[model samples]
Target: MSVVAERPVVAEESRAVRWWRRPWVGPLALVVVVFVAVSVPRYLTLDPAQSLVPPVEGFAPYYPMLVAHVLFGSVAIVSCCFQVWPAFRRRYPVAHRWIGRAYVFAGVLPAAVLATVIGAKSPFGPVARVSNVLLGLVWFGCTLAGWRAGRARRFGDHRKWMVRSFVLTISTVTNRVWGVVAGVVLGPQLETTFGGNEQYMTSTIAGLTTWLGWVVPLILAQLWLDRRPKKRARAAGRSGVPA
Candidate 1:
């Protein structure tokens, strides 16, 4: 067969083997949903002095950190929405690389550093502080790894690591959702656990959610990636192709 004829056949086969039809559409929808659901309220309602857990009234660094976290995190979230879209990646590889660079350096890195600082200042105690630091470190490291992989031209590794990093970044949205649920469920028990000190009770809840929010999404991503190869192999076998 001629190379030109084979090209279309190969492209068609690639599309047929894909995990989803138009995967970008669903995720793009989700990206918008998450922005509306979490990011909007976060900035709109932010009042440093009235912050529930950290109580930012007396702090200087906290203000800058808070601003950096919100702005840089927004950049990361929006950049990732484009980064993961198949149409964007395939049709605009140059743009993909640029956005990925911004996502890592201008977005995740700054956000994670500021987060570590803010987490260290947690008013609740050591538990919240440790979780925050750990989460920030992991976020920073995963994003850096993805960038390095892209530079090395290991595109598969780049995608996997970038997906993992994006999942961690979006924990900002998940963290808030979990916090609301915890507040409602644990409202009556605040006095029982913290001697009626609402500040400490809020602190405890924040600390727990900090760990749960990032950890859960990462675990789910790991499971999905691990299954991907096996699923692809099964598909290939059914099609009488060598896995």
Candidate 2:
């Protein structure tokens, strides 16, 4: 057996893994995220009664807050899909810049603010309210840091912070996923546990999901980022240049 003959299989395997990680994996996940984000807006507009907002009385503030959160959040989520697409980012850098600007300012900032306010009034109770407040603050902080890094010409720092921000932004979907699972598992026990009060059970579950949803995904992303090589190093390797 020759060394060169044995190496071809290794090289082919490496290429397959790279292709899966790049175009296939990222694009497929992006499609799912974009689909969910786009579908959510319809519930906000077309099916308000059947939407996530609880039908509590004295709907003075909750209604407006829900609307603002949904609209701005939808904008942010949709914009994020384009911003993170590797091909779009590379081909249309200028468009990427503008989309990111709109994402941070018009989408994330307003949505986070509204989320904090709405969370305070959650029918579930103080636990969920506190979770919302924390999530909102962290989301806003990550996005602002990302924007500031870009302004300071620290592209690496900007990219890291933006990745964190986008993870938090996409947590809306994760949160819902958790919520559904919890509802299904805890459905029968809710009445017995919470004195048959749907509101109390709802509040408890919301708080639990809020913490688990975003925190777990952010942790996973951080681990991936820590393991991944720096972009400059990757480019250097590709170009046969020293890093």
163-237: candidate 1 lDDT, tens digit per residue? 899889878777877888888888889778788998788778888788888999999999999999999899889
TM-score for model 1? 0.85
**Whole-model lDDT values for every prediction:** 0.81, 0.82
Count of residue pairs whose backbone atoms collide, per candidate: 0, 1
Q: Each model's RMSD to truth, in Å?
A: 3.1, 6.8
Clash pairs detected, candidate 2: 124-203
Count of backbone collisions within predicted model 1: 0
Q: Write the residue-wise lDDT of candidate 2 on 81-117 in tens digits.
A: 7777666676689999999999999999999999888
What TM-score, computed on C-alpha atoms, does each candidate reach?
A: 0.85, 0.77
Q: For residue 177, give model 1's deviation from the true position in Å.
A: 1.9
Q: Which one wins on TM-score?
A: 1
Model 2 TM-score is: 0.77
